[model samples]
Target: MPCRWLLAPGKALRTRFARPLRCDVNNSRRMLSFLSSMSPDNAELRAEVARTRLSVAVGCITEVRGADAIVNCANEHLVGTQLPYINLDGAAGCVFHCVDGVVHKRAGPELHEACMSLAIEEGSYTETWGGIRCPSGQARVTPAFSLPHCAHIVHVVGPPWPSDAEELRDAYSAGIKAALAVEGPEARPAIRSLAVPAISSGIYQWPRDMSWAAAVQSLGGHLLEASLRRGGAGELPCPQDGARSGLDHVIFSAWDAASGREVEECLRRWVDGTLTEDGLL
Candidate 1:
């Protein structure tokens, strides 16, 4: 299938940081074919995978609307730390360079309070970091107050750069798990769509390529596992399965056009089997 790209109008993301949001979608037969070839015996699984839409986009995650939940790359302390030394030229003097800071800033102080409450519930305090709320590779969920679009936000802490790749993968997986488990009000529907940023790809310094690849692999594996369980492959029945209905979309977001292009390329490779269980080809 030929690759196609769509760039959302700049005005949409201009509420705070004005910039164009570029999105790349691939509803390719190649991806379905790969899934079919991998699971010839499980037609249901292949169909389920085909129904789920995965995309890569370039945009400020705070401006992403319509997602049932968005994932935040949070630190262990859940505090939005300001790195005054690092300056993003186009950030409009927004000292919040990291995603964690950006999210906290946009979402208001309420988010900070919620995170602290969540930390207390989890009993994850530690002296090493002066009371860590969420340890590395862990995830927590909170209401997206002040940010009216999404119902919830999943805060995830990833391992530092050049660390255990498995741990990074776990952080992505944990975010998905936390998002799936969110139980919103009766008027609100189950989380059927999620927007995720490249965890540990920024100030933490994990290579963007490696971070996105791990994200894709983890989410793909999750959908596959969910399909298996839903198809009666003999795994424990997921209780939230009925509530969720199923995740219809998972968007991987990049902060800028260059990174967005990189994410799209990575996704394209995954669809064609160039990026696989072992690593990128």
Candidate 2:
């Protein structure tokens, strides 16, 4: 389902989603509790979420490893290209580049050449996110080629801030689905988890509140849909086997405290179904 902003007065946000994966407050709480008890990979996020209750679907992280994929908030220039160098030789997960945060530069030299092969000139890329379909809201997925610790890289272009407000959710959700859609068990190590950033926050200048809300809602809604059923190979990994949707364990990486706090509160409201016009961060 395309990400819809479906809010009605007095109705819980959980139920407002396309599907009802969050059963009830009891279920939400239970799921939230379950997140905390997972393996070491998720321990910190579990603890963080418990203390803050900011988001049941979103996790804030300082470092990433073992995730099926990680998000890079790029720009037209793919700014902030720096990804952590853990093990360059280790074939790791995937990295979803949202915006143009120069992740390719850091991934390795040949990474840029691979992106060029996708043929997304700035004009076409911007046009796509602006609502025209060169396949609107779609992403170009490619093998990471030489980026260490990642097997593939999904590049997504979010709408230019202040212009395509409605498209942010599309960009976020598309980036994620594309990552999971990558065919092959050879891509296994990182297909089950994903990482993203606060798209449109920097040079794009999106208010921190909008960034988190769009992100969390997209994630929560997607997870619910996957858990309710199963779509094909392109589907985001859901705990259909009773594990968890790789999409559910989202990481909203922030560079500042203000953005961090906003994501937390915004995510909390989304989970609680309390986010409203008056409750914006």
Candidate 3:
């Protein structure tokens, strides 16, 4: 379970006359997004992370492709947002609150209609979804309907501020598991690739440092679980063991540079045997 985040600088973020070298911070103030991929530093880090089995990327969610599934960080109501953003510096840029709108919009209207129908009409049978509204820190799996590349979508509701870090971690884990469900009895998971965003990093104001750390933990667990399912409990798993898993990729796509860098470091440290002693989360 390697998570990838993709980030880029804000569109309106220009060098200020007074602080010509501080455009990064200036951009952070406008809206949260994946912003570091295009930057030289981020570009290098992205390449470095890719060398590892588990990794993170900084980029736009809409721009992602080849995933068998994608995650939608939804609210309890599972509704979408306008993904609005106003440039504090120049009144431009589109910051996002949730990825639901972007996923559904690109997937086409049928995707939204399916969600609405499930909430308002049929309701879900999953233990996680209690009727129309999904609970916080839980995930529910659904068909993509019109999303051409993805066969499924995992909708997870991240909790607001003040919730336990464990809760946030659980939310991510659930989403990943749901996204990697098997098609039928005795079948491997239908999803081979998956994409996720920074859950609860926006209006929820979840701490970026710990939240991203939790993300790493969740993905780590995902790989471990895959190993256990395929190879059993006694043996340790190699990166190649991941081939038995339904997922070939688990990308944590981002729109901001900070998250991208943070997740990349997490993967790097873990691979280098540093996370065990350094205590990242």
Q: Which candidate is the best by TM-score?
A: 1
- All candidates in order of lDDT, best leading: 1, 3, 2
Off by over 4 Å in 1: 1-52, 82-96, 120-130, 185-189, 227-240, 243-246, 276-281
Error of 1 at 195 (Å): 0.4
- Residue 245, candidate 1: how far off, in angstroms? 5.9
The predicted structure with the larger TM-score, 1 or 3, is: 1
Q: lDDT: which candidate is best? A: 1
C-alpha lDDT score of every prediction, in listed order: 0.66, 0.50, 0.58
TM per prediction: 0.69, 0.57, 0.62
Model 3, span 1-281: residue lDDT tens: 22223232443322211212234663463112222222333433333333533545576665667677777877665545532222324433324434676676677777656665654324544344334456787777778776666677888888765455556767887787676554633454566567778787665656565566666656654554454365532233344433356455577777679778777776665444344211244
Which 10-residue window of candidate 2 scores lowest in summed lDDT? 53-62
- Each prediction's total of clashing residue pairs, residues at least 3 apart in sequence or on different chains, is 0, 20, 25
lDDT of 1 by residue, 77-152 (tens): 7766532323444443344466787788889999878876664425655554346777888998888888767878
Q: What lDDT score goes with residue 113 in model 1?
A: 83
lDDT tens string, model 2, 230-252? Answer: 43223445333433343435556
